[model samples]
Target: MSPVEEVLDFLIVGAGISGIGMAVHLTRDCPGKRYAILDRRDQLGGTWDLFRYPGIRSDSDMHTLGFSFAPWKHEKSIADAPAILEYLNSITDEYGLRPNMRFGLKVVSADWDSAAARWTVVTEDKDGKQGRVLTRFLFLGAGYYDYDEPYDANFPGRKDFKGQVIHPQFWPDNLDYQGKKVVVIGSGATAVTIVPAMAKSGAGHVTMLQRTPTWMVSRPAKDRFANTLRKFLPEKVAYAITRAKNIFLQDLTFKRARSAPDKVKDFLEKQLKEHLGPQYNAADFTPPYNPWEQRLCLVPDADFFEAIKAGQASIVTDHIEKFDKTGIQLKSGQHLDADIIVTATGLKLAMAGKIAVAVDGAPVDFSQHYYYRNCMFSNVPNLISVFGYVNASWTLRVDIVGEFVTRLVKQLDAIHAQVAIPVLAKEDEPEAEDIFADFSSGYFQRSKHILPRNAPSLPWRINQEYRKDRLDMRQAPLDDGILQFRRVRETVDA
Candidate 1:
């Protein structure tokens, strides 16, 4: 019953992959160091727990998806949702992580007390009981997928002619589409995945509606040679080869699209045409820019095409004008009838929603900050938001950050320092016009002004390249002007 034992050394928010990964690392490396993982859900695996949509799977292969220390032992590169969840559960059990987790505990806010040199966390349990925890440091492993569907298509409709209207994120458990016509709105990953599965389940008809075209690159879920190599050679070697190959192809296609214009894209369209046949046009599905600008949605084993070929699904390249009682009215003077309307219109980006830091008890407005190295927020003291690569497996970058964080924590202990904060100079902040012109979608754009900017941007500054990150995050001096450190606090027992 010691008060000090009650206070943990570190408080990690979210028990998902990142949170669980951080816990495993800290516990294994530091040993007996007090740390607790808080998650809002009743169970572990944030997205894996929340998303129960059909055909849900990882975009990247399992080789790079799993932790560096843990290799995914599966024959196929792309795995289904249940298998992924099981894999995560096994890790949780193997590491004995459940005991360290505070489930159904949602963190309302985190405030850093400068004088105490500690973080004060306020949490509300599922039963509405409020409790507080104090910790020496805080790490946010809360991922981007926390929020549900941002905008439910509230189209003008007659409530009188109702059939079920569902979003894939919150799909109905008793929803039966057998021999029923279905229309999935949006061309993103969610919609693409849903259409095929619905078709396979004996749905009479399924159609996907897209407002804008997206780059849909369909490939086999399993690569034979790579899988065989993984069996014979070491897992790491096989993973490295697969990762390198994917990276090379991604970069090559991106460079060709950006530098060589429509030539390469046209070639891709020709291939698409050959596969999709005469009635189906590829241009309706091709993207405006090069690949990797925005992440390309991965259809498992080109299942979307298979659905189309089987006459189970089709695509409508038009906007929905309004909703009738039974179906939707498109702007192109077309009426599409359906018994179920599934809106999979992508996600709304939120930048570090779980993190709310205050200095000396004043709330720090993170949106005004610039990102430094895309890891640490500018002018924010003792905080880092870990984001991964767009081209490769996200976990790869996360694992690197985990290692780096451990190293940094160890460094602070060695130096007798209490705080490590990112310090951004006024001169480093890019102008408004420059920022608006350059920044893209998702987390990057959401944190644009506050994040660190590279001069002569684009090809030079984009953090997609791993070597630059290694230089900035690993090789850079700790005492550099970018981050400031402060001394540890001592309390008198007199």
Candidate 2:
């Protein structure tokens, strides 16, 4: 190792849920892996630290969103950002993950030299200072979202608008909209959450401006069944039961929604009517597309509708023609006056965490390869990327990925191997399938072309099923004949 370079067995990137979970798993499972985690930000919490928008909370239940090793003791299943951040911090502190993590260093590039059987990772810190780390294995556990660049919809006349415009990705502090009219644009979870939160937080009134309706489901903020189970069983046992129950029920609900869209749609709209009142416009709540085609916005305890019933917030289904000096003007000839406008538009999908990868000094293109087992990309030597499901809690898939990676690391060590690469021979390459074909969300559509397309069959299919993935990653054999193992040759000293 050079004065500036440090060598490690594993280099994990992005100190978020996945990275933290990876650290915990490595410490417990692969005891002496000699790993290091690198994060670009000063803090460890990845998305929680990045998104400071009002009413920031989990769309999934906490029982499943929380790490598998850690049972969510709190009753609030749909937790807010601060509570979530605290949970992550607790995990980091408990596992002693802080000492192994070098903060403020963002991975800029990673190059694999076949002869050395190690990756040369180049990173730039917050200070614009460059550093290097050489490691035998590289794990990309960075949160899927691109922190530096937000998805821009290129709203017409955005420059002409006079009122302060804010994006949920980088929400500013001391942003005073108290007792002032607010308009939040977008139909996703962020818009729904902000509309209700701002209303209750003393905004004069808030309107959700949407071009199309999003599927909204009202679920309990607390997990009653899980809490009851915990009362009778031990922590791990109770967590297991709740986790299994929630996963089955959520997956069953998803399958049912996919099979019977009309029934699910009617039930959801009926629920909305019950909360919003008898005269509530079901058309405003009805989405043209089926549920699960795009992820449904989960409104905990119908709080969003409660805000509307209390005359604090409203929903406007109209296309914005342009942003005038005061507010947004609709193409439907209606104008919405606003003191503040929030573009909860969405984020750009970045599969590789924006880090450049090269092999033998040649830049690697992710689009050219297929994702093997939804974790490892084809021909990506000694690398595993953790990108989670769109329909379920991110931690569900992340936890599974962590366990699988640990198994791989141990297997490599057992075989005296320095590198384990996914090699796709001619027969192994299957037909490409557009995995994001059904997802019509703006974010998915924005960068759909850049995402790695998977094969239609096993080992390459992009799985959204949590139980299936758990079985596949946890119980499956590490030697699937697809992974090629290599070891560095010992050179005799002259």
lDDT tens per residue, model 1, 257-277: 567756766666665665678
TM-score of 1: 0.89
Give RMSD (Å) of candidate 1 vs. truth: 3.5
lDDT of each: 0.71, 0.86
Worst 10 residues of 1 by lDDT: 432-441
RMSD of each: 3.5, 2.0
Candidate 1: misplaced stretches above 4 Å?
Answer: 1-6, 145-149, 158-161, 425-462, 491-494
lDDT of 2: 0.86
The positional error of residue 270 in candidate 2, measured at the CA in angstroms, is: 1.6
